[model samples]
Target: MKALKPRRFGWWYVAEWRLRGMRSYRWTILLMTLGNPVLYLAAMGIGLGALVRVDVAGVSYLHFVAPALLVSTTVAEGFNEASWPVMSGFRWQKFYLGMSATPLAPVQLAMGESVAVSLRLWVQSFTFWLIGLAFGAFDGLVSILIVPIAVGAAMATHAVVMAYVATIDNDVVMTFMYRMIMMPMFLFAGTFYPLETMPVFLQWIGWISPMWHGSQLARVVAIGLPEPGWLIACHVGFLAVWTIGGLLWARRTFTKRVVV
Candidate 1:
């Protein structure tokens, strides 16, 4: 194995490489990055929200949905980042293989990828939160809490998916995952509506979803939504477990694939 470089530079190299590749599509990325929050808030919050005309969760429909959307969007971004990019790194471009040849260990590569994804989630979540502020969806300064909550959701999802990707030989399963798994979680995990409104059988989906946990925490932090302290502990605990478990799995898989 090559001698490890300085730890900081090793991590920076991994993250910077990914960012440089992303720079090629900066215009498209910028457009979608800013445009999505505006359009979603306008269409779902204003247009559809007008017809409902009921204060949901003790707040306007827009406000209730805004934090949830921030969490959901970050979850979606995390999944997307983990899906095709992870596949490409292993199979198509074999970039992870190349990185393994250098001073970077498999664990370092994984951590670096995580750092890049986390930074992207931070920017995306903040952009959405800022737009929400302009729309008057956020309550006030406290609503800034959505960014960290959203990033937490992103990290949890990204870590789990990265581990899953490490074990798979092909990406065809990703399509099924997006359609059958992610879509259901997005639709039913307290994003568009509260979980109580959903039937009992469906509530379990949200219970297991990182998006729901993150969204609930966001609502509590953003607008002082009332929730039991134990439930809050559950949310935090579950996300933490997912992140830790997933990283452990990813480290094992990466070591098998790259180091050995």
Candidate 2:
């Protein structure tokens, strides 16, 4: 018998359709992505940063918050793609069943949404970084190099959350996960202050949080500071593993779910 061929992950078509559908709302997306951060900067970076300026990690308040926001928002947006939008496809829109009727696989649909979500995260983070720069929070060119790293960290964050989202048979459990798990992570993951100042027990949260890992790496790159090479490697590598592994698991599960 001829050797069996390995199945390829067919997600590009899924990506194409998602992207095509997004065109009509592109302007709205652009405005929301770009404009909201302007308000964030105006409100927080200027408004809040003004109230506090002792330097948490040897950086200004605005600078300190920028990196935290980058990772938090990335994860937040990624989870959005994984949660509501994906739910809409399966329930309100019933798009998944329709696609399942065709050659398109469930994994492809999920993967495509994850990719699209990455794009959304990229848009949001980059806009935040650029706006942060205008407000003098970016620090320097070294900070700019971290953009792609931040994106990777964000994508990795999306991976685990999206994988979990795909495993759900309904939306209720995931909603609880967001509130009980994700929201807390966003708040304590070194967004407003350095992880050093937190209680020893609470620091564990930041240690495991993908956003914190990404935030640390981002500060190194964005602020021209030196970090332990091994620590940096470990953080980035762990995030990568989560991302790739998440993609595989999510695709497989989604494929199975679509057939059922």
- Number of the predicted model whose lDDT against the real structure is largest: 1
Residue 36, model 1: Cα distance from true site in angstroms: 1.1
Candidate 2: RMSD over Cα atoms?
A: 3.3
- C-alpha lDDT of all candidate models, in order: 0.87, 0.74
Q: Against the true structure, whose TM-score is highest?
A: 1
| Candidate 1: C-alpha lDDT | 0.87
For candidate 2, write residues 164-216 as lDDT tens digits. Answer: 76667677887797887788888888866788888998998888878888888
lDDT of 1 at 143: 88
Please give the distance, in angstroms, between residue 200's alpha carbon in candidate 2 and its true position after superposition: 1.6
Q: Could you tell me how far off, in angstroms, the CA of residue 161 lies in candidate 2 after the best superposition?
A: 2.1
| Model 2 error, position 203 (Å) | 1.7
Q: Which residues of candidate 1, in runs, are more than 4 Å off? A: 1-9
